[model samples]
Target: MTMRRTDVVIVGGGLIGAWTAFFLARRGRKVVLVEKGVVGAQSSGTNFGNLRLQGRFPGQYPLSLRAQALWEDIEELIGDRCEFDPSGHLYIAFNDAEREKLEKYAAVSESHGLAIEHLGAADLARRYPWLSGKAVAATFSPRDATANPRLVTPAVARAAKALGVEVVEQCTVMQARREAAGFVLETADGRSFGCDHLVNAAGAWAGEIAQMFGEGAPLFPAGPPQFVTEPFPYFIRPSVQAVDGTVIFRQIPRGNVILAGYPRTAADPIRNRAPVPPAKTLAAMRHLTAVVPALRDCHVIRVWSGIEGYLPDMIPVIGPSMTTDGLFHAFGFCGHGFQIGPGVGLCLSEMICDGSTETPLDPFSIARFRGAVAEDEKFRREFDLPAAAR
Candidate 1:
C-alpha cells in the first residue's frame, strides 16, 4: 500500500468538511480531505439554500448570528464564488395559531440580536401583493439570505486546493485507527494516509465513523424530498417558509421555484440515493400552490432527495470526540446544516488551530451523548434504532 502523511485529515467533503479544510489550509496547515464521491454530492449540495435566523433553535442562535456575518464576507475571505443572494426571508402565518407562533418567535429572536419585522395582514399585502390571500401575518428578516448549494462545496474545495490542500475524491475509507503518531486511515483502493488530527465530518455516515472510535451518537439519516418548477415569471423575492413548516419555497433569479416540505425519507448511506415518491411530490406541489396560487399552473421540472444526518435532539454533534484525543467531529446538522456550515467549519478550525473559537460550542459537545446508552434504549421504544443508524 502507498503510504502518505499529512498534518490534518478530513473524512468528509461536504460544506463543513470543505470549509474546514479551506480554513486550515489558509492558516498554513498541511491538510488532506477524502471524499467517497464528489464534494457536496449529498445533502450539502441538495439542500434548500435559505440562510435565515428566524426559526433556528435557541441553542444555535449565537452561531447563526456569526454565520450570517461570515456569509456576507464569504467571497472575499474564501476567494471562491458563491451565488449568494441577500433577498431576505419572509415567514408567513396562515392562521391565528401560526400568527401567534411567529410573533412569539420574533420576540425571542430579537433578544438574540436578530431583528425580525412583524408584518400584519395589511402590511404583508402591501409589501408582497403577489402572495396568496392565505397569509394572515408574517415576519421578515432583512439580513437573511440564500445561496446556490450546487456552488458551495466545490468552490470551497477549489479555494482550499489553491492553498495546497490535498483532495482525494472517489476514495472510501475502509479502515481507520488511532496510533501514537495520530490517526491512520486506509482506503479501499490500496491507499493509506496518516495525520496527527482527524476530523469526522462525514454527514449521514458520521455515526459509523464515530462508532469506529467507540463514540456512540444516535444519528439518523433523513432524505427530504425537493422539486423545482419550470421557468416562469419571478415574483417571489424572499425565500418563504410557513410558520407551521409544512412548506418552504424560493424563486431563483432564473424564474424556477424550488420547494420542499414532505417528511424525510430514509436513505442508504452506502448508495447515497433516496427515491422521492410521486405522491409526496404531488402533495408538496399542492401545499405550495395553496400559498402561491401562481404555482398552481406551473410545470414541474424536476424532483429529488438527498441524505442528511439527524440527531434525536435535532442539534449537531460538533467538538472533540470524548474517547479520542486529537479527534474532532462536526456532523449531524439534522436538516439545517447548510445555513450554519461555514460557522461550524470556522469554529472547528479555531478549536483545532487556536484551541478554541470565539463562538460558543460547549453546547454541541459529544460528552452530552456519552454514556447515554440507557437513554438510547429507552428512546428506542418510541422510535426504532435501525432507523437511527447510530
Candidate 2:
C-alpha cells in the first residue's frame, strides 16, 4: 500500500474543500485534497450561483460579506473570473405578507452594512417593466451577484494545485481514524494518507465522516431543482427571486435564463442521484412566468440538480470538531455554499494555522448539536425535514 504524509488532508473536493486547500497551500501548509468523484461534480458545481446578501441569516453576514469581497476580486485571487457578475439581486413581493418579510429582511441587511433600495409598486414597474404586475413591492441589493457554479470548483482546484497542493480525485476515503501522531485516512484504492490535521468538507456525505469521529449531526441530503431556458434576447440584468420562495431566476449575458425551484427535491447520497421532477419543472415554469411575463414562451432546454447537505437548523458546521483534536468541519451548507466558499476556506485556514479567526463562528460549532437541535423556522418551511429531526 502506498502511504503519504501531509500537513492537512481535506476529505471532499467541493468548493469549501478546494478553497481551503488553496488557502492552506498559500499559507505554506502541505495539503492534500481528496474527492470521491471529480472536483465540483457535486453541489458545489450544481447550485443556482446566487451571491445574495439581502436575505441571509443575520449571523452569517460577516462571513457572507467577506466571501463576496473575495468573489469580487476573484481574478486577483484565483486567476479566474468563473463568469462572476455583480449585476445585483432583486427580491419582489407579491402580497402584504411577503412585502413585510422583504421589509424585515432589508432592515436586517441594512444593519449589516449592505445597501438596500426599497421600491414601491410604481418604481418597480418603471424600473423593471418586464416584471409582472403581481409584484407589489421590491428590494434591490446592488452588491449581490451571480457566478458560474460549473466553473468555480475546478478553477479553484487548479489554483490550489498550482500552489503545490496535491489534489487526488476519484479516491474515496474508506476509513479514517485518529492515531497517536495525528489522523490517518485509508482510501478505497489501497492508499494511506497521514496528516497532522483533517478537514471534513465532504458536502452531503460529511455526516459519515463526522460520525466516524463520535460527532453525528442530522445532516439530510437534498437539492433544489434547476432549469434553463433556450437563449432569448438579453433583457433581465440582475438575479431575481420572489419573496415567497417559489422561484429564482437570472438571465446570463448569453441570453439563457436559469432558474431554481423551491421546496427542495430529495437526494440519495448512496445512489448519488438528485432527480428534478417533471411536475416541479412545470410548476416552476408557471411561477417564473408569473414573476416575469416575458418568460412565458421561453422553452426550457435542460434540467438538473445536485446533492447538498441540509441541517435541521438550516445552518452549516464550520469549526473544529468537539470530539477530536486537530480536526475541523465545514459542511451541511443547506444550498447556500457557493458565495461563502472562499470565506469559509480562508476562515478554516486561519483556524488551523493561527488557532482562531476574527469572524464569529461560535454559531456554527459542532457542539451545538450535543442535545436536540431546534429546527430553524426556515428549515421547516423550505425542507421536508426527516422524521428523526422532527
Candidate 3:
C-alpha cells in the first residue's frame, strides 16, 4: 500500500495518544495513531491504576480535579466503561518525620481547594482496624479510586477507533524530522507518514525520541516491578497503603490486589528491561501484610512491570516541542497520567487542532526546566525515595 498523509500523526497509541486521537477525530481532523507495539501495551496497560487527586502538588491539584470529573463521566464520553472506582485515598504516615510531611501536605492540599481530613493513629485504627499498628497517622481524601488499567487502556483504543481514528499497531517510527508542510515520519517497516503536527507519547522511550531533537533533560526511565494476588474475599475497600510508606496496594472489583514499591534493583533507564521481579513481589507482599494483615493469606497470581518516564520534577511534560514546529510531546507522566489521561487528551487536542491549549500547561513545559523555573528539581528532592525506589 502507498503511504498516505493525515492532519495529525500520534506516535504512541497509549491512552494519552489514543484519547488525543479521540478528541481530534471528533473535531474532524484525519488522525493516524501509530504504536511501536500493540496499542496501550506499555505503561498504559501496566502500573497501578490509582485515579487519585490527593498528594498532587499545589499547582497540579486543580488539573487533577478536572481530570477526576472527566473520568467520572468517561464511560458516557467514550461509550465504554472505564471501571473507575471512587473509594478515596489514605496517605499513611508512620512517624514524626513522615507525619510532618503529611501534615504539611494536608495544609497545602486544603489551600488548593482539596478536601483532606487529618486523622490520628487511634482514629485511623478505629476507622479501619485492619491497618497495622505501625501507621501513626493518615490524611484521607474521599475522591480517589482504583480501576483496571489492563481493561481501560484497550477500551480507550477501541473508543478512538470508533471515532474514526486510524490506529496502526506494530509500526515503529524509526525517524522523524520537520518538513515545510508538516512533520515527516518514516517507520522501521519502510513506510512514510506525514502529519500537520506530531505528538510524542511513547512512554519510557520518549527520551529516546527527545534525544533525537538534541534536547537534554533529567528524563529518568524505570521498569518498576509489581504484582497481583489471586482473587479472594474482598477484605479491603479503596486502596490500603502503609504509613511506613514502602508499599501501595489497591484491590480490584474481582478482589485481587495490585502492588508496586521499592525494589532490590531499580531497572536502569537505557536498558529499561520490564518484568516484575520475584524479590520486589515478595517485598510488596510482606509490606502489604504489615499494612493490612488480612492480605498475608492471599496468594499472588501474577507479577508484571513496565517502564515509566519521569522528570526529576515529578510533573508531566504536556506542552509543545519548543525547537521543532509541528511537533509536540506528552511523555514523562511519572506514573500519574492514566488518571489524568482524558484531561491531557483534551488539552493536547486543543493545542494541536486549534493552536492553543486552555489549561495551565506552562507548569509542565520542557522549557521551564532549562530556564530558572527549577520547580522540577525541587520536587525531585522533596519526593525522593530511598535507593530501593531510585
Candidate 4:
C-alpha cells in the first residue's frame, strides 16, 4: 500500500475531529483528518443542538462551563455564525419525586459554582409565557446556548483546511496497525499513511478502530431517533429539558424546533438508513405539547436518527488507551458530545501535543470498565428523566 506521513492523523472528521485538527494545526502540527462520509453526518449533526448545563453530570460541569465560555466567542473564532443563541436553558419539574431529583441535581451542579437560577411556576410562566403545560418548578442556566451543528461542522472544517491541515472526505479507514515508529494506517482504496501519533475521534467506530491495535474494547453503539418541526416564529428561546431531562427541545436560528425522544434509541443497526419512527416523533410531540402547548399547531418538517458508541456505564470514553502507544480517543458521547466535543478536542490536543492535560481526565477514561459491573442501570437511574423513571 502507498504510504503517507504526518505529525498527527485524525480519524472521523466530525465536530470532535475537526476541532482537534484546528487546535493541533494551529500549533503548527502537520495533521490529516479522515472521514468516511460527509462531515457531521452522524450524532454530531443528527442530535438536537441543545448546548445546556441544566442536567450534566457534576464531573462534566466544569468542562461544560469552560466550553460555554468558548462557545460565546465561537462565531468570532470561526469567522461565521454557528447561530450561537445564548438564550439559556430550563429544566422543569412537577411532583415530589421529580422535584426531589431536580433539587438534588441542582444542588450538586450548583456546588460546582454554576449560576443556576431556580424559579417557581409563576415566575417560570412570567419568564416563558408560552410554557402553558404542566410544571410546578424550574431552573435556568443562562449560559446554555444552541447552534446549527450542520453549519458549524463544515465551517470549522473550512478553518482547519485554511490553516493548512489536510482533510480527506469519503475516505474510509480500513485498518490501523501500531508500528514501532508510531502507526501505519490504511484506507479502503489502498492509500496508506505513517504518522507519529493518531487520534481516534471516529465516534461510534472508535472501539472498532482501537481493536486493530489490540487495545480498545468493542464499544456499544446506541442509535437514537430525533425529529425537527417546521419553521415557527418566536417559538422557543432557550433549550428546554424535562425535569429529569428525558425530552430536550430547542429551536434553531432558522426557527425549527428540534425535539429529542424520551427512550433514546440504542446501538442496534450499527448505521441507520431510515427516517425516525412515527412513534418516536409522536412521543416527542406529546412531551412538547405538555410543556409548550404552542407546539400543538406546529408541523414536523423532518425526522432523522443516528448511532453513537456507548460504554456500559453511559459515560463518554476520552483520553489515551493504556495498551496502545501514541494513540488517543474521544468517543461514546451517548447524545452529550456536541456541546462538549470542542472542549474535549482541546483537552485531547493538549494531551497529545503537550504530553499533559490541564482538564480532568478521570471521569472519561476508558479504564473505568476494566473490572466494572453492569452499572448502566444505575447510570440510567441517575440521569433518567422523571417521566421515564420507572
Candidate 5:
C-alpha cells in the first residue's frame, strides 16, 4: 500500500494533461501525471495536427491564440519543434453556398482579430497553381499551421519531466474518490495517490470521472479517419480544406500528403480502438483527388484514427467541477483539442494556483450540462451521433 502524495494529480497523459503538468511544474507545484498508456498515444498523437486559428468557435479565439503563441515559441520552450510548420491554412469553397459559408467564416475570424484573405477563383488559381479550378472562392489564414502529432505529446511530457513533474505511464486510475483533506486515486497496479487538486483530462474516458462527482455529459467517442499518401514531390504549401467538409489535406516538407475525412468514424474506448474502415479510406481518397486533380494517381501509404470524446454541443468541459472542489476538467474537445491544448493547460494551472484565469471559461463550465445541451450545427454535420445519444 505505497501511497504517493502530491499537490496536483492529472489523470491523463495526452496533450492537455501533459501541458497542464508542465505548467504546474513550471509554477513550482509538486505534480504527478498518471497515464493509462504511453503519453500522447491517443487522440493527441493521432490527430490531423492542424493548429488552425481560423474557423474556430468564437469563444475559443483567445485561448487558441494563446496556445498559438506557445507553439510559435515551442522550440525555445521545450527545445523541440516537433515538426511545426507555419504553412498557413486555405479553406476552399467549390460552390456558391460554400463560398458564402467561407465568407461568413472569414468575417467571424476577422472580427476575432485573425487576419483572413478572401480569394476569388482567379486569385486562388494564381496563388495556388496546383489547386483545382472547381474552387470558386477561398480564405487563407497565414498564422494557421501544422505539426507532427506523433512527436508533440511525448516531447511535452519529456519537457514536463525535465521540470520536476513525476510522469507515471502505463498506469490506470481504477478509482478516484474525494477525501476530507483532498482526493485519493487508486491505480490498477496497487499504488495510491493523494492530491490536494485533481485534473481529469482523460480524453474520451473523462466522462466516467465526472460521473463519480455527480456530473454527467453526453460525451461520446469518435475519430476522424486520416490517411497519408506515399511520398511525392512537395508542391502543396498550405493545408487545404474544403468548406463542404469533404476533405482536408496538407503536404509536409518530406513530401507526404496527410489528409483527414469527415463524418467521424465510430470509436470503442473500452477496447481502446478507433479503426478506419476501408470504405471510408477510399471515400477520402476520392474526395482528395476530386479536390486536387494532381493527386488523383497518388497512392495512400497508410490510414488511421484515434479515439476522441465528443459532446453534443461540440465544445468541451474545461472548468472546475460543479459538485466537487479542487476538481477540474478539460475534455471532449471534439477533435479541436490539439491547437488549444497549451492554453487549456496554462489556464488550468492559473485556476489552480491563482484561483482564476483571464480567459472566459464560463462557456465551458461543467454546469452547462446541468441543462439539455443543444447540439451545435457542426456536430450534426461532423458526426453520426451514437444510437443512445440520438
Candidate 6:
C-alpha cells in the first residue's frame, strides 16, 4: 500500500470539496481530494443550477451574499463561464396566503440588504406575460441567477489540479481515524493518506464521516426530482419559483426548460443514481404549468435526480467539529447548496487559513444539534416548505 501525507485531506469531490482543494492549494498548502466517483458526478453536478438568493435562511444570507459575489466573478477564477446567467429570479404567489408569505419574506430579506422588488398582479402580468393568471403577486431579485452545475465542479477540480492539488477519483474512503498528530484515511484500494487537517464535504455521505468523530447529525439523504424539456424557442429568461416552494423552473439560453420542486425521488443512495419515475415527472410538470401555462405544451425529454443531505432544520452543518480538533465540516445543505457552494468553499478555506472568516458561522455550527432536540424540532417545522408539510 502506498502511503502519503498532506496538509489537508478533503473527503469529497463535489463543488465544496473541489473548491476547498483549489483554495487550499492556491494558498501553498499540500491538499489531497479523494472521491468515490468522478468529480461533480452527484448532486453538485446534477442540480437545477438555480443560483438563487430570494428566500435563503435568515442566518445564511450573509454567507449567501458572499457567495453571490464569487459567482459573479467565477469565470475569472475557474477559467470558464460555467453557464452563469445573471438574468435574475422571480418568486410568484398563486393565492392570498402565498402573497402574504412572499411579502413577509421580501420584507425580512430586504432588511438584510438583499434587493427584492415586489410586484402585484397587474405589474406581474405586465412584466412577465408568460406567467399564468394564477400568479397574483411576485418578487424579483436581480442578483439571483443560475450556473451550469455540470461544468462548475469539474472546472474547479481541474483548476485545483493545475495548482498542484492531488485529486484521486474512483477511490472510496474505507476507514478514517483520528491520531495524536492528525487524521489518517484509508481507501478501498489500499491507499493510505495522513493529513494535519480534514474536511468533511461528503455531501449526502457527510454524516457518516462526522460519526467517526462522535458527532451525531440527524441528516437524511434525499434525491429531489429534476427534468428538462425538449429544446424550444427561448422566452423565459429569469428563473421562477412559487411562493409556497412547490414549483421551480428556469429556461436556459439554449431553450431547454429545467424544472424542479420538493417531491423526493425514489433513489438508491448506495448507487448514487435515481431514475425519475414517470408519475413524479408528470406531477412536477403539472406544477410547472400551473405557474407558466405555456409550458403545458413543452415535452420533457429527460429526467434525473441527485443525492443531497438534508438536515432537520433545513440548514447545513459548516464549522469545526464539536468532538475533534483539526476537523472541519461543510455538508448537509438540504436542497439549496448549489447557489451558495462557492461561498461555502471560500468560508471553509478562510477558517483553515486564517482561523476565521468575515461571514458568521455560529448558526451553522454542528454544535447546534448537540443536545437540542426541542429546538431542532421547532426550527425544522419553521423551515420546512409547504410541499413538505404533508
Task: Please report the candidate that would top lDDT against the real structure.
Answer: 2
Which sequence of candidate numbers ranks them by lDDT, best first?
A: 2, 5, 6, 1, 4, 3
* Model 3, span 259-378: residue lDDT tens: 776542344545546655566677778888888888789888888777677776678888888788767888888878888888888888998878896578778887766764344543
Q: Where does candidate 2 have its weakest 10-residue lDDT segment?
A: 381-390
Q: Which pairs of residues have clashing backbones in candidate 2?
A: none
Tell me how far the alpha carbon of residue 283 in candidate 3 is from the true structure, in angstroms, after superposition: 1.4
Runs in model 5 deviating more than 4 A are 385-390
Write the number of the candidate with greater TM-score, choosing between 1 and 3: 1
- The C-alpha lDDT values of all candidates are 0.85, 0.93, 0.78, 0.79, 0.92, 0.86
Model 4, stretches more than 4 Å misplaced? Answer: 266-275, 377-390
TM for every model, in the order presented, reads 0.94, 0.98, 0.92, 0.93, 0.98, 0.95
Residue-level lDDT tens digits of model 5 in 321-375: 9899999999999999999999999999999999999988888888988888888
lDDT by residue for model 4 over 117-202, one digit each (tens)? 88888898788899874888888888788887778888889988989999998998998888788898889888898898899989
Alpha carbon lDDT at 301, candidate 3: 83
Candidate 1 per-residue lDDT over residues 176-293, each given as its tens digit: 8899888999999989999989999999888878888998787777778888999999888899998766689999989999998556666777676777878778888888988888
Pairs that collide in candidate 6 are none
Sliding window of 10 residues with minimal summed lDDT for model 5: 381-390
Cα RMSD for candidate 1?
3.0
Clashes of each: 0, 0, 1, 6, 0, 0
lDDT of 1: 0.85
lDDT of candidate 2 over 115-195, digit per residue (tens): 999999999889999998999999999999999999999999999999999999989998999999999999899999999
